[model samples]
Each structure stands twice: as structure tokens, then as C-alpha cells.
Target: MARMCAERVIELDYSCNGARIRLVRESGQDDARHREAVPAVAAPVVVQDRPPADDDAGAQSLPQIIEITAQMAGQFYITPAPGEPPFVTAGDEVAEGAPLYIMEVMKMLNRMEAEFACRIIAVLCENGAGVEIGTPLFRVERTDHA
Candidate 1:
């Protein structure tokens, strides 16, 4: 049994006697039963680096866009209450620690905040939508970058 200390999930790959096997296990799961098996000949691994930019001059001047993703799986909410206005909208400037949105997990509400001052470029998730961990919630451009 493999122990997952800090990670929430773990994936492992094994090759034995020309057979390829993939094992996916979540934290706290003790079972290691083989899940997916594929012929070694049918599986190929490919790794590639980013291609060079076409126009270096323009690329260098472009503003950096940052994506904000959910830290946990939950139901996403735009406003604190049903009749209240949303915490933010596209083009809104937000300060560090400002509330961005709310996430409801297991009937508990968690307020999400901005880590740095930024301008909201877009709201990626729909209101009242179910979201998984690492789901993109917003796109923003940092305003405090020096």
C-alpha cells in the first residue's frame, strides 16, 4: 500500500510483462486493485515544450492574465444573498483580500477572496453552478505588478 501524505489524489503507472496498468487512488483509500490495463504496445508517451512565439515584440507587451480556480469542490455563488448584487463584475478593480465570490460545500458557505489587487477580466463560472476542485472561476489581470 502506498501512502499519500500531502496529496489529495495519486496516480501510478506500471509496466509488467508487456502490459501497461494505471492505478488511480484518492487519499484515505486503501484498496490498490488494478483499475485500467492497456497493452504496452498501444500506449505511447509524448512530451513537448512550448513553441516559440511568432511575434516576440507584441508578446512581450501583452498584459499577463491570471486564472483564479476553486480550491475545493462546491456550488458556486456570485452574490452573498439571492436579492443582493454580485460581489464583482467584469472590469471591476478589486483590492487584495476583497471578497470575490462564495462557495457552498456541504451546506457551509466559504468566501473566496482575491490574493492580490487585480481587475476582473471575466467571470468564468455561472451562478449557482456546481464546480469541482481546480475549476476556473475567474480571469483577472494583476494591477499591482511592478
Candidate 2:
């Protein structure tokens, strides 16, 4: 008797701002468990003198940019626990109440659930990375039904 093996090659490109990739080998899994962590980079703050006192009609409302922002500062996690499969991935249609991500703060895991059905448009955060408050973690499209 002889054993047959499969050949595979996986490439991870971490060519984004504040991102790191981690790969895991698993048995019977076609793709590797790819984990990523990204942190919010602080932007340089610029203060400007109050707009000419007579040239303002108050701040105008602009179209809003919807994004899933982190509530607190902590590391982001895709799976419920280490070595477990992720809750969702890009292009995965998730229904309301679906577990989307986890936030680990002070060693405590907080599960983040979806509010509405949507398709994962992009994963904005990296696994095992620190995210500041109000950082976009995921970008999803709100679908009629998922």
C-alpha cells in the first residue's frame, strides 16, 4: 500500500496599512487558517482657526459613510476561539443575528453579532491587532435578505 499526498501553495500578501498575517496548518483543510491583525493608525491632527465669523452657516450635513466601528480599544478576532473556524469571510452572506466578529479586551472575549443581513464586502480589521475606538472593522452591504 502507498500513501497519496496533495500539493498546495498559499500566498498571503499583507500589503495594507497596519496589517499582519498569520498562517496555520490544518488537517483535511484545503485553505490555511489565515489570521490577520490590524491596528488603527493615529492621524496627525490639524487645528484651524474658526471659520471667518461671518462666513459660516453652521456645519453642513454630508452623506454619511457607514462602517462597523469598534466600540472599545482591543484586539480583533474572527473566530470564537483560537483553532476554530471563522464566523464569516468575504463574500459570505450572513443573516441577521449571525456572529460576525469577536473583540478581546483584557483577556475577555466579547462576541459581536450582526444587526441585519448583509454580504461581507471587506474585512477592515486584522486579527490579533489593537483597534482604537471608532475604527472600521468590517464593511458589509445591507441586503434585502441574506
TM-score of each: 0.59, 0.53
Question: Global lDDT of each model?
Answer: 0.73, 0.63
lDDT for position 48 in model 1: 16
Give the alpha carbon lDDT tens digit for every residue of 1-146 in model 2: 01222323234345456677643333344444543343333221112223323323332222112367777778889888789888998889888778888887667777778776767777877777798777787777666421
Model 2 bad stretches (over 4 Å): 1-65
Q: Where is model 1 more than 4 Å wrong at Cα? A: 1-61
TM match of model 2 to true structure: 0.53
lDDT of 1 at 31: 46
Global fold similarity of model 1 (TM-score): 0.59
Winning candidate number (lDDT): 1
Maximum-TM-score candidate: 1
* Candidate 1 lDDT: 0.73
